[model samples]
Target: MRILFSSLVHTGHFFPLLPLAAALRDNGHELLFATGSDNHDTITSLGMTPIEAGIGLDVGAPTAAEQLGVDPDPKAERSPEELVRLIVTAFADVLPRRFVADLEPVLAERAPDLVVWEAGNLGAMIAAKRAGIPSIAHGFGRVGDDDFDVQGAEVIQRTAAEFGVELPGGRGFGDRYLDIYPESLQGKRFLAEEADLRIPLRPVPFSKPGPLPAVAEGERTRPLVYLTMGTAFGSAEVLRTAVAGLSELDVDVLVSAGPSVDAGELTGLGDRVTVESWVPQDQLLPRVDLVVHHGGAGTTLGSLGAGVPQLFLPQGADQFIHAGVVTEAGGGEQLLGEAFGADAVAETARRLLDEPGYRQVAGRIAGEIAEMPSPAEVATRVVKPG
Candidate 1:
């Protein structure tokens, strides 16, 4: 069977799905990605073909708000409810609409038998439905308390109606759901919780392959902490503040600034810290004593898979939710609001290192993740050979 994988343009959304794609490829199925034009090389680098599709959320977000006639003054603050409504409108409506348009052509040209979409790429399934193909929704991490499936279903139904497209009327996205989260961290509600076809595939953390970014290049010394804001969030100030806190400890801090941030601009932090635009996270997590990062699903599950404790400085998206879950699960700690600072980070890192409970829980979660079906084992279930 031929499969077309879909995700939001960003690496955080795009990377998690790659392991599964690679797994399917290893099973002798052809696979490709439909995402932003900029991600073409990123996909091709991993030896997969890329077909550009849809705009980024940054472009689709404001447009969704504008369509809703909820334009806000730049100077004004947005209420929590309004912010969520806007997000729902974008992912469930505007972005999906655009994605359907872009994917219609690709679907016709590619004629893929299966469409596997990450949680963020809601429209790909709709496109697949329109093309009379099967589709599956794949999750990246622990789902929050939000009822995205039920609420988003309403918006998706309306979007489908606008296009005069009739869906199979299962869940909002698709009937089949690929659940990558470890069963322990699944929290209260799971994505596609009610779907009969929901299946668990272990969260395999993936990043661009690279050498370890440690500049000192030594066998073993003091503890090493891998620091990052992930691909979508964080700033120079955050990096510097985190590094300052990590500095207080007798640990080495290596920061993966992500592609958006220039490592050269982050000079003068002295020799205690090493900054790289990116690092091989799959390789780095186990080497680190602890992880300090924005709670991205890739990094969160990656750390858990490595049995490494973490200090989450959540910036946005599911980071806050992830922080709460990890803290509750005893696998890590979260820093937010007034509590986020150099002192707080230093103090938290101390607790994470000095305390063994965090590592123990992380190890348990790692064991759970390891026991879950591997991507290769699950790939055959996603799309069977014709």
Candidate 2:
């Protein structure tokens, strides 16, 4: 079967779809990815055909943040709840207009057997429906958010009207759903219940091709701590705060501030601290003793997959929800808003290291993830060549 995949063309959104896409390719399915032209090189690097479709937020223009009068300083000022409203509105209301224009032509020509789209894309949903093709919804994080329904419906109403498309439910999640978020860490929104066919797939960790650095073999001299703020929310203020806290500890620290922030700004913090733009988290997660990071979905599940304890410093979006759920589950701790500082990061990371309960819970979560359906299994379930 020839399958077409779509995402927001951003790192966090695109990475989640890769494992499943790779699985289908390995199963002898022809694959095409519809994203921004900006990611054409990246898609080619991953050994897949690229079909340019969606556009990410243009900092040069007025975005949903500006429309909502919210300052988008890596979400330093607003709460995650406020940020989520902006996020949902942008993808569902604002950006879909452009996506429909770019993707309609591609849909007509490619005419793939099926479409699998990231949760943020309502345009892909609309395009697939217009083309009379089956599409499945793939989630990047926890089940759902309270803001998801309210924002998705309100904006989708206007969007449906403008496009003259009849959206049966005014919701983005499709008839079939790929549930990547583990039940242990799942939120109250419960996306599984919303879908007619819910397939629970394991959240396999993935990092772009990179050579893993050699860590000392047998007995460790000191615990290794990995720090990252994700590709989108790489704030120097938060990174410096985290590095300062990690440096205070006896453990050696490795930090990746993503492409948004320059490594130079993060350098010269401490002799024990090392900064880079990227690291192989798939290989590094198992070796690290603790993780200090923004509570992005990929890292949270990646660390849990490796059974590593964590300290969550959520900057914005769905991060705050991830932090709260993991903390409540006792697998890790979180620092938010006024509570986010060097001292607090130090304190929470210390608990993740010194405490046994956190590691114990993490191990249990890892076992559960291990038993869930793998990408290969779901690939077979989704399609079988007749």
Candidate 3:
């Protein structure tokens, strides 16, 4: 079978699909990745054929934004509710049309047997539907409450109209849904009441291939804490605070300042703290005792996969909800906007490290993740009907 995988340009959106794509490829299925031009190299680097489709906000002109008649100002302050609305309007509604437009030619040319898409990329589902092929909705994290109805409704309606297809009630995108999160971490609201529609796959942690850091080589004398604010939100101030707080403890700290943060800002912390612009979380998580991060779905699931307790300093988006799930599952703790600081972070790190219950719960969740179908198993199953 020829499987075509699609995602948005963002790393967080694109990375989750790789493990399953790899699984299918290893089984001798031909694979092609359809994403923005910016991600072509990343897709090619993973040994998959790349079909450049859609627009990258960072690389291309603001054609999508112009089409939507909205100016996106990253530094501008907006309420969380407003931000969510903006995201829904732009990425969910407007961008899917662009994705469909770009993907139509590929669907005609490639004629793939299956179209596996990241949950948010509604265009792939539309394109596949129009081409009369089955598609799978692969989630990045815990499924959002009402995500199918809320985020996908408009895109489905608009795209179905263009293809002259009738969408049955409650159908949004994809013939089947693939959720990677373990049952314990999947929030109550997002749990699928219908078992057959959703398939559970083990969340395998992956990152850009790289050599492990030297610090990860030796046996650790002290607990190791990994700190990151993710790619988009990392700042020098946050890095400094995290470094200061974690350095005060007996633990060794590995801080990924992200692309936005300057590594020089984290200098002079101490010998215990090693600061780098970035290090693959997959390379570091297994060796770390705990993770401190903005509760992005990828980071949250990655830490959980590694069985490492997390200290969540949630910034926004799904981070807040992921933080709640983490705390409720007894695997970690959360500090919201105002409460998040160096001192509070230090306190939570101490509790997570010293408290045996957190590790125990995290280990349990890890076991649950381990019990889910592996990517290879899922790849074989998905080729058949749901």
Instruction: Give the C-alpha miss distance for residue 61 in model 1, angstroms.
Output: 1.3
Alpha-carbon lDDT of model 1? 0.82
lDDT of 3 by residue, 1-386 (tens): 99999998877788888999999999899999999877788778778999987765442224434444555555557665555556665565566777888999999998999899887787777778888888888988776565434655665676567767555533334367788878877755446553557788888887877766677678879888988998777777877877777877899888888876888777888898888787878878888999999898889998988889999887766777788888998999998877877888888899999999999999998888889999999988989876
Better-scoring candidate (lDDT), 1 or 2: 1
Root mean square deviation (Cα) for candidate 1: 2.3
Q: Against the true structure, whose lDDT is highest?
A: 1
Residue 145: error of model 3 in Å? 1.8
Question: How well is each residue in 85-157 modelled by candidate 2, as lDDT tens digits?
Answer: 7766687776777777888888888889998888777788777877778888788988555766677777776
In order of listing, the candidates' clash counts read: 0, 0, 0
- Comparing candidate 2 with candidate 3, which one achieves the higher TM-score? 3
Backbone steric clashes in candidate 3, count: 0
What lDDT tens digits, residue by residue, belong to model 1 across residues 22-57?
988888888889999888987887778899898887
Q: What's the lDDT for all of these models? A: 0.82, 0.80, 0.79
Task: In candidate 3, list every pair of residues with a backbone clash.
Answer: none
